[model samples]
Target: MKLIISYKLDSIENVIPEKQIEIIKLFSYSKSDFIVRKIIEACNLKHPNLEKIPAYNILKNNLNEIINNCLDSIAEKRLVNNQFDMAIIEVVIIDNGHTLIMKLKDNGIGLGENYLHKLSYPEFKHTKSQEHFKKKEKDYCIGGCGIGLFHLNAKLAKNDAKLYLKSRKEAGATIEISMKKPY
Candidate 1:
């Protein structure tokens, strides 16, 4: 149950260095206490941030959503895989002067086709129902409301950010977010 997190940030000149360091440090310190309860072997994070701006708050909130998505992926894997081993999560942050691009990729059982379809629209409700939970009492049930992606999409939209998700059954999934940089 070990989850390794690794990240890369390109072109630091585009972001506020102090904010970037603070955010990464926060993640490194609190990752061990994540609700997923997984061991982390090696984790590296890099990103740029805006200093003393509402943009930082917006991005910070969005980052929390990103973490939720990662946790959801882990929960899905635990439910489907017989023997869930280690998982590696790779995050990339790119600063293009005007925008910040973030991509999160993970090695786990990918999304089901039906699930992926549900994610295409923000209004779609796709969580596993309580009835399904009742049947899964003896099975692995991580208790997800299935609103992670929907909420993520909404968050991105509020910040004029764009999101792209690519998932294949049994293969892993990747989530990419692009947003204008905060001044």
Candidate 2:
């Protein structure tokens, strides 16, 4: 797949540049160490001191959703098309002493045209999966109940997080979450 992942480091005003880079680098390193490391390394280009923060679990969940739900869906689609179309994932972070914000942008097929509206409702649910995804990878499986985002959002909300999602059919999607730092 023609996938490119990039980081917007300049927008992080409150965090020191070195620390911002460190955090971003940590995120990239996580991608490399993901379950599908080879596929990630093949399709993507070669890409934190917060060892024991309370938000670590939350961050891990977010990473899981980003990979299993977001990027995996894109990869599955590519398998069906038998070609790699262009896709981009951009991560932007803003950290101040009081609050932290992370935004992700992806050019992969978005959460469908009406997903955002449905997501606004408390009872929203949907699953987009393909059989090819299961057959292509031994370590991965296809099928989801579509509750990952809901659970993640709920957890974030309980932590006083603010989330914004903008998505479209062909235009891709942007997800931004802002929350307080637990330090």
Q: Using lDDT as the measure, which candidate wins?
A: 1
Superposed model 2: Cα runs more than 4 Å off: 1-56, 77-83, 127-145
64-143: candidate 2 lDDT, tens digit per residue: 56554555545544544443565457666665666666666776556565556565568776534454244656644432
RMSD of each: 10.6, 11.2
**Can you give the lDDT of residue 148 in candidate 1?**
67
Give candidate 2's whole-model lDDT. Answer: 0.55
The CA root-mean-square deviation of candidate 2, after full C-alpha superposition on the true structure, stands at 11.2
Worst 10 residues of 1 by lDDT: 35-44
Q: Write the per-residue lDDT of candidate 1 for residues 146-165, one digit (tens) a residue.
A: 57667767666776777777
State the lDDT at 169 in candidate 1. Answer: 62
Candidates in order have lDDT scores of 0.57, 0.55
Q: Candidates' TM-scores?
A: 0.62, 0.57
Candidate 1 Cα errors over 4 Å, as ranges: 1-56, 120-122, 127-134, 143-145
